[model samples]
Target: MIRHRDIWRALDTLAERSGLSTSGLARKAGLDATAFNRSKRLTGDGTPRWPSTESLAKVLNATGVSMAEFVALMGEGNAQALGQRIPVIGYAQAGESGYFDDAGMPVGTGWDEVLFPAIGDPNAYALEITGDSMAPAYRDGTVIVVAPNQDIRRHDRVVAKTVEGEVMAKELNRRSARRVELVSINRDHDDRVLAPEELAWMARIVWASQ
Candidate 1:
């Protein structure tokens, strides 16, 4: 059953994913800035106060999130509707053994889990940036969600693994059956061109937590 806590948490999640604070979300919804504030979640007597239906609708519309998504966010537990629990590893550790298979799918062990928005790809994983090489575009500590099932398009940001166990995130300058060209966001880093034999696998970076 839906509860006050779940509803409030759902709002917080919605604001977070929308890149807004609760007040910011409220303001954007044309409501008072404190509408979804924690202090307003309870009355002066500390009793629960639910958000009005009108306010909820406004927030959903303001964020371009449907009612279904908002209700899913209020799920009781780790329901499929909540999101996917995908493997997460640091970019620095992606080159290590036992973390992935030749197909770029995560395998073996030593992987942590992070809840990511469902994008219909069970093989999706998250890579936490650990260096400045991918900065400005992907700063250190940012988490990038990789979708192996997604088609890699030219000029798309991608994460690739080399046959030599090297893993790097770069923009796909060009792609062909035999060779692919990569351009790094950092100017100090040299771009690369590799043949099929040199690249183990490459996947498009669908989303990132900056």
Candidate 2:
């Protein structure tokens, strides 16, 4: 059965396969740049606005995708495929309340989501970089996949959240029973030595959407 979310995910997947954003895809197809935007997916009265066949055909032709290829893309992100999706949020919002549980698992609502090829932990979530602080290694808007249940090791990129509500991304230098030593992702930022007792949770950064 075709569901509302399936069509949206298929559109997003199509855009990804073509190396374009949804707006870019629409523009490339000679449609309004917002044609496939999430905001345009529903009417003002809240009815779903299914993509018109004409628009679909235009996009398919523009991307050189056959009907069969489009159908295949539609099937690629069904419920079974969401096993690889992780709830994502901006780094600025990572420290906000109700977004994470005590163990740092994603818990609350309003999470922007993404489909990744692979994630080591089922409970893993993603963080979108929002500033220049993590430059050189990670640029603004970069999406990083983090696994809260994974073991932290030396040289592994990590996401650490503190009890005072600070969340940071850095490289693991060393971890002992008491404290964790970390190197800054940007050299301009100083290194850190965090006491484990002061941390809410710390986890390994497993993948990135570069």
Candidate 3:
């Protein structure tokens, strides 16, 4: 799993490679000069505060750094490091408060954590499968890593949470300005098409611990 320090290390590396300082890098990315300052790396409570996806996107664009290369700059692997983890929760439990914020990013410390592979997105999380809704493709006990910042395209498997707190994993059969058509993995389950207003946020499924 990518740890907090890993992210900071990557940003610093990006600045060094660009012949600039952290503040300079942030400025080039159209962010405040102190955005990447060490003092701003943590919150008042000392908890780690990761760079937002929007900010990271800007930095990558400004530096011409591909997501793959940026992830590589995070240094060596830490999956073997005991207790180093990322947020995870059961599928049904996601509807409950405190697990996810309004943007569908994991928030609060109530979630269970597990070591997962690097996926480019700092806010990536895992969801344990719970029922037959996405069986065959993803049955009960399967743990899927979700990349909220990953690009979504046709035929990509995705996890979508609705405004009513309903979450479903489905294939992106088609997406348009007004409707999102999803194909269910289980033949027994009917395909679904949701209106733009029905979806709160939809993220791509990057990995499955099958």
**Judged by lDDT, which candidate is best?**
1
lDDT of each: 0.82, 0.80, 0.82
Q: Candidate 2 — which residues are off by over 4 angstroms? A: 1-83, 118-120
Off by over 4 Å in 1: 1-23, 26-79
- Output the better candidate (1/2) by TM-score: 1
Candidate 2 residue 28 C-alpha distance from true site, Å: 20
Lowest summed lDDT across 10 adjacent residues in model 2 is found at 76-85
> Candidate 2 clashing pairs?
none
Decide which is better by lDDT, 1 or 3. 1
Measured on C-alpha atoms, candidate 3 has an lDDT of 0.82
1 or 2, which is superior by lDDT?
A: 1
What's the CA error at residue 33 for candidate 3, in Å? 54
Ranking by TM-score: 1, 2, 3
Give me the displacement of residue 181 in model 3, in angstroms. 0.6
Q: Which lDDT tens digits does candidate 2 get at residues 59-169?
A: 876887754456556675444443466788878788988788899898876676765434457888889898889887788977778888888778999999999999889
Clashing pairs in 3: none
Better of 2 and 3 by lDDT: 3
